[model samples]
Target: MNMPNYFELFDLPVQLPVDVSLLTANYQQLQRQYHPDNFATANDNDKMVMVQKSAMINDGYHTLKNPIKAAEHLLSLKGFDAATEQNIIHDADFLMEQFVLREKLEDIESQDDFVILDDFHSEVFARQHDVYKQLLEFINKQDWEAALNQIFKIRYLTRLIEQIEKLQEKQYAL
Candidate 1:
Protein backbone atom coordinates (compact mmCIF):
# COMPACT_ATOMS: atom_id res chain seq x y z
CA MET A 1 0.00 0.00 0.00
CA ASN A 2 1.23 3.47 -0.78
CA MET A 3 1.90 5.23 2.50
CA PRO A 4 -0.31 8.25 2.83
CA ASN A 5 1.24 11.34 4.32
CA TYR A 6 0.72 11.16 8.08
CA PHE A 7 -1.49 14.23 8.07
CA GLU A 8 -3.40 13.04 5.03
CA LEU A 9 -3.66 9.55 6.50
CA PHE A 10 -5.48 10.80 9.58
CA ASP A 11 -6.80 14.04 8.09
CA LEU A 12 -4.73 15.67 10.83
CA PRO A 13 -2.62 18.83 10.86
CA VAL A 14 0.58 16.95 9.84
CA GLN A 15 2.19 18.83 12.67
CA LEU A 16 3.03 18.09 16.28
CA PRO A 17 0.35 18.52 18.94
CA VAL A 18 -2.37 18.20 16.31
CA ASP A 19 -5.86 19.54 16.89
CA VAL A 20 -7.27 16.46 18.60
CA SER A 21 -10.93 17.32 18.04
CA LEU A 22 -10.45 17.61 14.30
CA LEU A 23 -8.45 14.40 14.25
CA THR A 24 -11.10 12.48 16.17
CA ALA A 25 -13.93 13.71 13.99
CA ASN A 26 -12.06 12.96 10.80
CA TYR A 27 -11.10 9.49 12.01
CA GLN A 28 -14.67 8.55 12.82
CA GLN A 29 -15.88 9.92 9.54
CA LEU A 30 -13.27 7.95 7.63
CA GLN A 31 -14.00 4.81 9.58
CA ARG A 32 -17.72 5.03 8.86
CA GLN A 33 -17.16 5.82 5.20
CA TYR A 34 -14.74 2.93 4.60
CA HIS A 35 -16.36 0.24 6.72
CA PRO A 36 -16.41 -2.85 4.44
CA ASP A 37 -20.14 -3.38 4.60
CA ASN A 38 -20.68 0.13 3.33
CA PHE A 39 -18.68 -0.86 0.22
CA ALA A 40 -21.14 -3.53 -0.89
CA THR A 41 -21.81 -1.71 -4.16
CA ALA A 42 -18.14 -1.77 -5.05
CA ASN A 43 -16.16 -4.62 -6.67
CA ASP A 44 -13.71 -6.74 -4.65
CA ASN A 45 -10.76 -4.53 -5.63
CA ASP A 46 -12.57 -1.36 -4.69
CA LYS A 47 -13.68 -2.90 -1.42
CA MET A 48 -10.08 -3.83 -0.66
CA VAL A 49 -9.07 -0.27 -1.31
CA MET A 50 -11.59 0.96 1.19
CA VAL A 51 -10.44 -1.61 3.74
CA GLN A 52 -6.80 -0.52 3.38
CA LYS A 53 -7.75 3.12 3.64
CA SER A 54 -9.76 2.39 6.77
CA ALA A 55 -6.83 0.54 8.27
CA MET A 56 -4.54 3.44 7.49
CA ILE A 57 -6.97 5.82 9.11
CA ASN A 58 -7.09 3.72 12.25
CA ASP A 59 -3.32 3.43 12.33
CA GLY A 60 -2.91 7.16 11.92
CA TYR A 61 -5.44 7.95 14.60
CA HIS A 62 -3.68 5.69 17.10
CA THR A 63 -0.30 7.20 16.30
CA LEU A 64 -1.43 10.74 16.95
CA LYS A 65 -3.79 9.94 19.79
CA ASN A 66 -1.29 9.67 22.67
CA PRO A 67 1.55 12.07 23.37
CA ILE A 68 4.17 9.37 23.86
CA LYS A 69 3.12 7.53 20.71
CA ALA A 70 2.82 10.78 18.78
CA ALA A 71 6.31 11.76 19.85
CA GLU A 72 7.67 8.39 18.79
CA HIS A 73 5.91 8.56 15.46
CA LEU A 74 7.20 12.04 14.85
CA LEU A 75 10.73 10.97 15.68
CA SER A 76 10.52 7.94 13.43
CA LEU A 77 9.27 10.11 10.60
CA LYS A 78 12.32 12.28 11.18
CA GLY A 79 14.59 9.25 10.54
CA PHE A 80 15.56 8.56 14.13
CA ASP A 81 16.01 4.84 14.74
CA ALA A 82 14.01 4.64 17.92
CA ALA A 83 14.47 1.11 19.14
CA THR A 84 11.56 -1.19 18.52
CA GLU A 85 10.22 -3.54 21.23
CA GLN A 86 12.86 -6.17 20.48
CA ASN A 87 15.69 -3.69 20.98
CA ILE A 88 14.25 -1.99 24.07
CA ILE A 89 17.24 -2.81 26.25
CA HIS A 90 19.76 -0.28 24.97
CA ASP A 91 21.09 0.32 28.47
CA ALA A 92 22.65 -2.45 30.54
CA ASP A 93 21.91 -0.74 33.83
CA PHE A 94 18.23 -0.55 32.96
CA LEU A 95 18.11 -4.26 32.12
CA MET A 96 19.87 -5.18 35.38
CA GLU A 97 17.40 -3.10 37.34
CA GLN A 98 14.53 -4.92 35.63
CA PHE A 99 16.19 -8.21 36.50
CA VAL A 100 16.34 -7.31 40.18
CA LEU A 101 12.73 -6.11 40.21
CA ARG A 102 11.54 -9.36 38.60
CA GLU A 103 13.40 -11.39 41.19
CA LYS A 104 11.96 -9.42 44.11
CA LEU A 105 8.48 -9.73 42.69
CA GLU A 106 8.67 -13.53 42.47
CA ASP A 107 9.94 -13.91 46.04
CA ILE A 108 7.12 -12.02 47.76
CA GLU A 109 6.93 -14.22 50.90
CA SER A 110 4.64 -12.20 53.14
CA GLN A 111 2.59 -9.03 53.33
CA ASP A 112 5.62 -7.35 54.83
CA ASP A 113 7.71 -8.50 51.87
CA PHE A 114 5.47 -6.41 49.68
CA VAL A 115 6.90 -3.23 51.19
CA ILE A 116 10.09 -3.68 49.19
CA LEU A 117 8.00 -4.16 46.06
CA ASP A 118 6.20 -0.91 46.86
CA ASP A 119 9.55 0.82 47.16
CA PHE A 120 10.59 -0.64 43.82
CA HIS A 121 7.37 0.61 42.28
CA SER A 122 8.09 4.10 43.56
CA GLU A 123 11.57 4.01 42.07
CA VAL A 124 10.29 2.69 38.75
CA PHE A 125 7.55 5.32 38.62
CA ALA A 126 10.09 8.04 39.28
CA ARG A 127 12.34 6.74 36.56
CA GLN A 128 9.44 6.45 34.16
CA HIS A 129 8.42 10.01 34.97
CA ASP A 130 11.94 11.18 34.28
CA VAL A 131 11.86 9.45 30.88
CA TYR A 132 8.46 10.99 30.12
CA LYS A 133 9.77 14.42 30.98
CA GLN A 134 12.77 13.93 28.76
CA LEU A 135 10.61 12.74 25.87
CA LEU A 136 8.25 15.71 26.07
CA GLU A 137 11.10 18.14 26.45
CA PHE A 138 12.86 16.66 23.45
CA ILE A 139 9.73 16.92 21.36
CA ASN A 140 9.21 20.51 22.50
CA LYS A 141 12.72 21.30 21.35
CA GLN A 142 12.35 19.28 18.08
CA ASP A 143 15.24 17.07 19.19
CA TRP A 144 14.15 13.93 17.40
CA GLU A 145 17.30 11.97 18.27
CA ALA A 146 16.98 12.56 21.96
CA ALA A 147 13.28 11.89 21.75
CA LEU A 148 13.95 8.50 20.16
CA ASN A 149 16.18 7.47 23.05
CA GLN A 150 13.60 8.76 25.49
CA ILE A 151 10.94 6.74 23.68
CA PHE A 152 12.89 3.53 24.23
CA LYS A 153 13.27 4.40 27.89
CA ILE A 154 9.54 5.02 28.07
CA ARG A 155 8.78 1.60 26.53
CA TYR A 156 11.11 -0.15 28.96
CA LEU A 157 9.55 1.47 31.99
CA THR A 158 6.08 0.81 30.63
CA ARG A 159 6.82 -2.91 30.24
CA LEU A 160 8.32 -3.04 33.71
CA ILE A 161 5.20 -1.46 35.19
CA GLU A 162 3.04 -4.07 33.47
CA GLN A 163 5.14 -6.82 35.00
CA ILE A 164 4.98 -5.22 38.41
CA GLU A 165 1.22 -4.84 38.18
CA LYS A 166 0.93 -8.54 37.33
CA LEU A 167 2.96 -9.48 40.39
CA GLN A 168 0.99 -7.16 42.65
CA GLU A 169 -2.25 -8.65 41.39
CA LYS A 170 -0.98 -12.15 42.07
CA GLN A 171 -0.05 -11.21 45.62
CA TYR A 172 -3.56 -9.91 46.20
CA ALA A 173 -5.03 -13.12 44.79
CA LEU A 174 -3.28 -15.17 47.47
Candidate 2:
Protein backbone atom coordinates (compact mmCIF):
# COMPACT_ATOMS: atom_id res chain seq x y z
CA MET A 1 0.00 0.00 0.00
CA ASN A 2 1.13 3.54 -0.62
CA MET A 3 2.13 5.68 2.38
CA PRO A 4 -1.26 7.06 3.38
CA ASN A 5 -1.74 10.80 3.29
CA TYR A 6 -3.85 12.17 6.16
CA PHE A 7 -6.46 13.41 3.73
CA GLU A 8 -6.74 10.00 2.07
CA LEU A 9 -6.44 8.23 5.42
CA PHE A 10 -9.22 10.24 7.06
CA ASP A 11 -10.71 11.22 3.73
CA LEU A 12 -11.16 14.73 5.17
CA PRO A 13 -9.35 18.03 4.93
CA VAL A 14 -5.96 17.97 6.66
CA GLN A 15 -7.66 20.66 8.75
CA LEU A 16 -8.49 21.03 12.40
CA PRO A 17 -12.01 20.67 13.84
CA VAL A 18 -13.00 18.38 10.99
CA ASP A 19 -16.59 18.30 9.86
CA VAL A 20 -18.19 15.28 11.49
CA SER A 21 -20.68 14.41 8.79
CA LEU A 22 -18.13 14.65 6.02
CA LEU A 23 -15.71 12.46 7.98
CA THR A 24 -18.36 9.80 8.36
CA ALA A 25 -19.25 9.99 4.68
CA ASN A 26 -15.65 9.62 3.60
CA TYR A 27 -15.18 6.67 5.95
CA GLN A 28 -18.13 4.85 4.39
CA GLN A 29 -16.74 5.60 0.96
CA LEU A 30 -13.37 4.07 1.82
CA GLN A 31 -15.06 1.01 3.30
CA ARG A 32 -16.85 0.45 0.01
CA GLN A 33 -13.71 1.03 -2.02
CA TYR A 34 -11.41 -1.17 0.04
CA HIS A 35 -13.67 -3.97 1.13
CA PRO A 36 -11.85 -7.28 0.73
CA ASP A 37 -14.65 -8.56 -1.48
CA ASN A 38 -13.70 -5.97 -4.09
CA PHE A 39 -10.34 -7.75 -4.39
CA ALA A 40 -11.72 -11.29 -4.17
CA THR A 41 -10.84 -12.06 -7.78
CA ALA A 42 -7.42 -10.43 -7.56
CA ASN A 43 -4.11 -12.07 -6.63
CA ASP A 44 -3.20 -12.71 -2.99
CA ASN A 45 -0.90 -9.68 -3.04
CA ASP A 46 -3.70 -7.34 -4.09
CA LYS A 47 -6.01 -8.77 -1.42
CA MET A 48 -3.39 -8.13 1.25
CA VAL A 49 -2.96 -4.57 0.04
CA MET A 50 -6.65 -3.94 0.34
CA VAL A 51 -6.67 -5.41 3.87
CA GLN A 52 -3.88 -3.09 4.97
CA LYS A 53 -5.46 0.03 3.52
CA SER A 54 -8.73 -0.77 5.22
CA ALA A 55 -7.04 -1.08 8.58
CA MET A 56 -5.31 2.29 8.16
CA ILE A 57 -8.57 3.94 7.15
CA ASN A 58 -10.26 2.58 10.26
CA ASP A 59 -7.50 3.85 12.53
CA GLY A 60 -7.55 7.28 10.97
CA TYR A 61 -11.29 7.49 11.42
CA HIS A 62 -10.89 7.00 15.17
CA THR A 63 -8.10 9.55 15.65
CA LEU A 64 -9.79 12.35 13.74
CA LYS A 65 -13.22 11.94 15.24
CA ASN A 66 -12.43 12.86 18.84
CA PRO A 67 -10.84 16.17 19.86
CA ILE A 68 -8.65 14.80 22.64
CA LYS A 69 -7.48 11.92 20.51
CA ALA A 70 -6.90 14.27 17.61
CA ALA A 71 -4.75 16.54 19.80
CA GLU A 72 -2.65 13.60 20.98
CA HIS A 73 -2.21 12.45 17.40
CA LEU A 74 -1.33 15.99 16.37
CA LEU A 75 1.36 16.25 19.07
CA SER A 76 2.87 12.93 18.03
CA LEU A 77 2.80 14.07 14.44
CA LYS A 78 4.79 17.19 15.39
CA GLY A 79 7.38 15.15 17.38
CA PHE A 80 6.32 16.64 20.74
CA ASP A 81 6.67 14.32 23.71
CA ALA A 82 3.99 15.54 26.12
CA ALA A 83 4.47 12.44 28.23
CA THR A 84 8.18 13.18 28.55
CA GLU A 85 7.64 16.48 30.32
CA GLN A 86 6.88 16.57 34.03
CA ASN A 87 6.61 20.35 33.91
CA ILE A 88 3.01 20.43 32.76
CA ILE A 89 1.96 18.64 35.93
CA HIS A 90 4.55 20.43 38.06
CA ASP A 91 2.18 23.20 39.10
CA ALA A 92 1.91 22.58 42.81
CA ASP A 93 -0.99 24.98 43.18
CA PHE A 94 -2.99 23.30 40.46
CA LEU A 95 -2.28 19.88 41.95
CA MET A 96 -3.56 21.04 45.32
CA GLU A 97 -6.65 22.54 43.68
CA GLN A 98 -7.43 19.24 41.99
CA PHE A 99 -7.04 17.40 45.28
CA VAL A 100 -9.35 19.80 47.06
CA LEU A 101 -12.01 19.58 44.38
CA ARG A 102 -11.83 15.79 44.36
CA GLU A 103 -12.34 15.68 48.09
CA LYS A 104 -15.32 17.99 47.79
CA LEU A 105 -16.81 15.78 45.09
CA GLU A 106 -16.45 12.72 47.32
CA ASP A 107 -18.01 14.46 50.26
CA ILE A 108 -21.00 15.63 48.24
CA GLU A 109 -21.76 12.08 47.13
CA SER A 110 -23.59 11.28 50.35
CA GLN A 111 -25.52 14.50 50.21
CA ASP A 112 -26.77 13.72 46.69
CA ASP A 113 -25.54 17.21 46.04
CA PHE A 114 -26.24 17.95 42.41
CA VAL A 115 -24.98 21.44 43.16
CA ILE A 116 -21.48 20.07 43.57
CA LEU A 117 -21.62 18.57 40.12
CA ASP A 118 -22.83 21.86 38.73
CA ASP A 119 -20.02 23.66 40.51
CA PHE A 120 -17.49 21.23 39.07
CA HIS A 121 -18.92 21.60 35.61
CA SER A 122 -18.87 25.35 35.90
CA GLU A 123 -15.28 25.31 37.13
CA VAL A 124 -14.17 23.16 34.21
CA PHE A 125 -16.08 25.34 31.80
CA ALA A 126 -14.32 28.37 33.24
CA ARG A 127 -10.98 26.66 32.76
CA GLN A 128 -11.94 25.81 29.24
CA HIS A 129 -12.30 29.49 28.48
CA ASP A 130 -8.75 30.13 29.68
CA VAL A 131 -7.46 27.19 27.71
CA TYR A 132 -9.29 28.43 24.64
CA LYS A 133 -7.73 31.84 25.06
CA GLN A 134 -4.34 30.16 25.10
CA LEU A 135 -5.41 28.14 22.10
CA LEU A 136 -6.19 31.36 20.27
CA GLU A 137 -2.73 32.67 21.09
CA PHE A 138 -1.16 29.51 19.74
CA ILE A 139 -3.22 29.75 16.61
CA ASN A 140 -2.30 33.37 16.11
CA LYS A 141 1.39 32.64 16.49
CA GLN A 142 1.17 29.41 14.51
CA ASP A 143 2.74 27.65 17.45
CA TRP A 144 1.69 24.04 17.25
CA GLU A 145 3.79 23.35 20.33
CA ALA A 146 1.83 25.69 22.63
CA ALA A 147 -1.46 24.56 21.20
CA LEU A 148 -0.42 20.96 21.77
CA ASN A 149 0.43 21.65 25.40
CA GLN A 150 -2.84 23.38 26.25
CA ILE A 151 -4.75 20.72 24.39
CA PHE A 152 -3.35 18.02 26.64
CA LYS A 153 -4.74 19.89 29.65
CA ILE A 154 -8.07 20.16 27.88
CA ARG A 155 -8.06 16.40 27.44
CA TYR A 156 -7.43 15.90 31.15
CA LEU A 157 -10.44 18.05 32.01
CA THR A 158 -12.53 16.13 29.50
CA ARG A 159 -11.61 12.85 31.16
CA LEU A 160 -12.80 14.20 34.50
CA ILE A 161 -16.16 14.96 33.00
CA GLU A 162 -16.34 11.44 31.64
CA GLN A 163 -15.55 10.08 35.08
CA ILE A 164 -18.32 12.19 36.63
CA GLU A 165 -20.76 10.85 34.10
CA LYS A 166 -19.77 7.30 34.92
CA LEU A 167 -20.17 8.00 38.60
CA GLN A 168 -23.62 9.42 37.96
CA GLU A 169 -24.56 6.31 36.05
CA LYS A 170 -23.44 4.02 38.81
CA GLN A 171 -25.23 6.08 41.44
CA TYR A 172 -28.47 6.08 39.51
CA ALA A 173 -28.23 2.38 38.85
CA LEU A 174 -28.24 1.64 42.57
The best candidate in terms of lDDT: 1
Off by over 4 Å in 2: 1-5, 81-87, 90-93, 118-133, 136-140
lDDT of each residue in 1-174, candidate 1, tens digit only: 433466766656545666789888988888888898998999989989888878878888887887677776676666664545345446788678767766665665344456776777788889888888877777888876667777777777788888777767776686
Overall lDDT per candidate, in order of appearance: 0.73, 0.69
Model 2 lDDT, full chain set: 0.69
State the displacement of the C-alpha of residue 162, model 2, in Å, after optimal TM-score superposition.
Answer: 3.0
61 Cα displacement, candidate 2 (Å): 1.0
Q: Give the TM-scores of the predictions, in the order they appear.
A: 0.74, 0.75
Q: How well does candidate 1 score on lDDT at residue 125?
A: 84
Worst 10 residues of 1 by lDDT: 80-89
Model 1 residue 163 distance off true place after TM-score fit, in angstroms: 1.3
Q: Give the TM-score of candidate 2.
A: 0.75
Clash counts for the predictions, in order:
0, 0
